[model samples]
Target: MPVTDYQGSTSSPFSFGRSLLSLRRDTTAIMPSGEEADLEAFQRHVASTLAELLPAADAGAGDEFLSAAWIRRLLEAFVLCQEEFRVVVAQARRRAGAQLPVAAERMVAEFHERAVKALDVCNAARDGVDQVRRWERLADIAASALGAPGEVHEGQLRRARKALTDLSTLLVDDAAAASGAGGVASFLSSHRNRSFGRARASPSRTAVAGAAASASASHFRSLSWSVSRTWSAARQLQAIGAGLAAPRAHEAGLAAPVYSMGCVLHLTAWALVAAVPCPDRGNALQAHHLPAAPPRAAFPWAPPLLALQERLAEEGKRKDRRHSCGLLKEIHSLEKSTQKLAEAIDAAPIPLFGDRENDVREAAAELAAVCESMRDGLEPLERLVREVFHRIVRSRVDGLDSSMHNAD
Candidate 1:
């Protein structure tokens, strides 16, 4: 059976595969140990290669999307190479961060530069720049990544590049209209799907994995440590990569290019780490912000963590709203407010932050002093929020009081 000939029927096995891909069942998951090792190595190679390309971007555009999005995609074969790089780097940071001294902390700046170049070229090409001045700089970066093994994003870039070439050669009226994402989506969708039937579970199981890991550290310190370290880097890379991957302005919100909360948290945490007066002193470590995660402690005072276990029992109760006359719009009104803030982030150029970062630095510094002086005033507030949110979640999911066993 020449698999391609299943052209028109719902009963086609090909169609069935398409359906599976959409469900996203851990198809790529749980691969054999050997395969996992190979995959990890392949990813590492990509991360390092991408790093080479950053210098070029840093040289050209410090804080901008480079050119526009459309033009570069048009020129680069529509490969959207940078997006893959983003994903790859994010993963690399987590795995490699533990190993690298300062690289993990500083990689974001490099990513900002690389994204600017790739995105610039993509936008320029899409907007009808018939023959762009040969960007010798981009070519240099692209050249280095051409045959590199660590070039994980290379595959992504190649596909996008092919699309760009095809669009230019064919003079496609609407490159997007012709984008065969649906077919590919269907194919992948059919081959692997997990959400076909609702996973009778909350995503928080995965979302709160960090919290849970921190909570049960004694029994699973090794597993928790590995997951936490890996996720921190992977998640950051994912954010930056995904932000620039999408066509500019298409879904700017999703591909948010500017400094995000994640970036803030990351830098803040690191600054706090560097600000640590002395590691040997238990008192200062206790006074630090976000509390250095509890991997080593038998019982860590991790807020998000404590919140999760507390959720085993607590349930949040929504407050009553009597001003039902559209007054409730205020809660969601923040949507627009969020957009402006996001735009402010994107519009601002790289070294995307200067004073705000300093502000955060100052804030982190004061946290220890403030915590020492403030003591338990807000601690009860913190505990209350933790207990309530958890109770609400547990009761909603389990339909019974999680704290029933612990009742007085």
Candidate 2:
């Protein structure tokens, strides 16, 4: 189905009678009326912001689709949706006399469970970013070796060859794993069920492990042991979506927003796994990886969300993308450029001269350009991933605190 423009949809949150917002309005009649408006505004803002992530119909999958910048925008949208959901829920609880209805509270708790799972996905994505950075460093070394003007010497050729070889090894290992092997899964798993109301220091161990993970490209071996051999991004995504369902007709008021936020969270995490390296992403990339598709007609945000999902899934099915380490556009460019450079280096005569020399130079320059794009893009992407991590942790803690306070 063609993606419907959220701004033009008759069922958008702007009009109340024909959609889920209407039911939400009915449910909130027992509370202060302003709470319903806040909830509606929350859904409207989510739809509009997410719609911005959709590419134009005629657009190609260039830097704007699943590129680093695009994924950052996706995360930014999720952050907004999360913050708004928190406010709307808190307001609903207040208007209902310091407590949500039993059904709404259940939905809130379920959303928090998904939020906790997302934290682990965030950490895994950070490692993937680090993995890409390591590749960048190696590529830079290769590019620098061949960048000098005039006749290229054997020393330069040898240095470039070694760098490319190392890069090839890293790429092969990464793809063989079918997702990068490193993550902070064990560290986060320990605190998985901890109540958010309790205060604690940030886990220094994670910082130390991340530092180690970011070490020189040669230390790629350490990544294999950082996370469990059995950890799979696909399973983690499945866990998040397990038991997730739309709110029943009687579960009104806050239920709709809770369901909306849950969908946002699941999509955000799934997309990260799609774009970044994570364990067993081959399985994660499958058609059945997502929870059964949510009804597109039932929610205003569904069109844009489904559109993005369909596009990413199409990218996954492409023959060129099948064996790739990650689906991020830069990764595709990285692999292609690196391969051309590697092939050029491999096919060069031992002494290197004439057209062959120019070929090597041309390939190195192309790889260098790809490396530069990654260098500029990966840091901001990493920062956004880190921000996502902190927000999920904060939201989970706040939700837990609110739940405890209400019980008291």
Candidate 3:
């Protein structure tokens, strides 16, 4: 936890352990097998060894002896971390298949995930932290876990690590379909399966459509950006990338001109599109999957849905729930982006669809036929719209926060 030089009262006895965390935290210093020394002297020798083992030149070695001690100490810590990570990653791989003991499986899985994550945090913590080759070797080790014979384990550890590596890649893929529609939270929570090794180059397949889902935020900037609501004031959020940043270049369709609660409604609508059942081509529209959710209580719409219930006063129409609580991807295991648009046949705003009542029936019929053939053909368009809305929502929040924080 604390970085220190091998000096003074900080030196502790050297000991070795198998746990990744414990190994990383090891502070004891032991001289080479040829000799042993007191804590300070041992620590000095460790520091010296670490410098030599690491690529750095043995610099600042005033008397040379203390330097070897310091470098060695550092190297010991590094080696410990590497070993710990290897074990954990191996365990995670072991979880691919077969009914291993519950405890072992859980322990292994967690170690794999966290080891990968910790490596990332550490790798980025400082410049010259470690060589890229070191990570590559870890990657190979993780991948080998996949060779465990069955489809399950084949390399789950390798898979997890690779996923983590992909996560470290550049922010967003603008040329993607859902390209500008999600954020860090959205990606981590919703797109895990589609991310890592499955990336595609165009919007022709599900993979392409999925990746495109997070592109550009240009649409949001076109919307009136400012002010924040008291209710949404405390949530700390990260900056959205291209896919979630969906901005417009001063020119785009329906450019989110108004700043009413319209953006929320629009986002909600997008969620509906993502949730409902749509027609399928190559099963893109029909292949049912789980919901992209805010989780149980983390459900963002609980408050609004509760209010919707109260506002209904008496019993309302059907039991149509907005399956996509915060975004479209969280729809029922049966929805597609295009289906939402078709489903929007019932979307409100009386005048927008012509004779209002008549248009619903017409649009419904047309949507059915269109979905029957095109399926997700319209998904890219929907993703773009969602991107715009995401930006709009984010900007409004940011503008408000900026003012609030700067108020005093």
Candidate 4:
């Protein structure tokens, strides 16, 4: 049957084959149609394509859901496309002479706004990995309960539970560090090490200081590299502003250094988070006695840095809270489904005929039902992933196309 027919049919058990086939068809349909030149039409096309990709109830994929790896790849693609769009916009702005074209400028500015929003969407989707992992655990539990081998399934569940615990700890630490409250011990310890290096004449002591500096430098480099695309884009925008006529640039909000400053602050907070020692390491280090380093002279930039740190911490808290709420919802759904599964298994009819054959058949049916329940719970999350992918791709493509047209 055609894919559309499957969509309208009564709900049925999940099937991996049908889900895969539908996804293939929907992805193919996302390509731009020749007639969709208008912006609204293009957006409609993208939205429809995304909607089409939603998981189907009758589509059999009982054991599978979208993977975090797949979402990461999609986000990477989105970021690369945004980078390309930024390049095109910068080039166009540079070529615009004394007076920028109002329409072109507006279009480009809108594109910039959308690109920023797209990044937020992508980040949220990336964080949704916890939700995906939770669903996977539930499915594994259901399978194991329905006669899957105990040893392998138990091991998988144990590992998954451990990962979730680690993730929660990391998020809490990250939120604290971002807020400036969590990293003081590590910072002070590193500072003391630096001071000791200056005081000690021994080669071994000096080497320790050098190693600390090297480690700090490496951490900074890694953090910068992680968001290098955003930094590069910000610089390009700054360059465009520099080249524009002063009045025009100021009117465009490009003259203000806010965008660049925001990017730098973001990078700084990320670096701090990276530099802070994990709780375990910090606890271990604090056990050793060392002389306190003399307080360093206050920097002129200290106030602003403190404020930025506070803001970043707040943002991190908000994100963590959001994820927690989502996780709670998932847990609630899993609980309900699990209760139902237990009831179904208890109520399942005993074999009047062949014992082994009846047990296998009943177990398989119960497993399928459990899988269906899990898939139903995941529909909202799957839709969210699809929508984010669509928005990012659509915005970047539209921006690139607009820039190219204006250049012509």
Candidate of highest lDDT: 2
Q: What lDDT tens digits, residue by residue, belong to model 4 across residues 338-404?
A: 3333333333333213554354335544544655554554454344334434444555555556657
Sort every candidate by lDDT, greatest first: 2, 4, 3, 1
lDDT at 47 for candidate 2? Answer: 82
C-alpha lDDT score of every prediction, in listed order: 0.25, 0.72, 0.27, 0.34
Residue 300 of model 2, lDDT score? 82
lDDT of 3: 0.27
Instruction: Give the CA lDDT, 0 to 100, for residue 219 in model 4.
Output: 43
What does candidate 1's lDDT look like per residue over 1-408, in tens digits? 112322333221112112333222322242233433433433333233223222243543321111122112111211122222233333433454323224333334444443332221122211211111111112222223222333224243332222222212221111112121221122222212121112342566433433332343223212121112222222232333343221234422112222222222222222221111111111211222222232212211123333322321121111211111011122112112222222232233323246543432333233223223223222332222222223223222221221232131
Number of the top TM-score candidate: 2
What is candidate 2's lDDT per residue for 1-408, written digit by digit as tens?
A: 011211222221122113445435643463365766777777776787678888876655444788887788788778767766776787778778988887778778988988888777887888888888888888889898998787788778756755655566567667767743222222122222221112332556434433333353347656643346787889998998887787676766887788888778888998898897787887898878777666777778888878878888998888778777888989888887876776677668757888998899999999899899898889888877877776676677778888898789
Least accurate 10 contiguous residues by lDDT in model 1: 323-332
- The deviation in Å at residue 166 for candidate 3 is 2.5
Residue 379's lDDT within candidate 2 is 89
TM-score of each: 0.17, 0.80, 0.17, 0.29
Question: Which residue ranges in model 2 land beyond 4 Å of their true spot?
Answer: 1-33, 57-63, 179-218, 224-226
lDDT of 3 at 258: 15
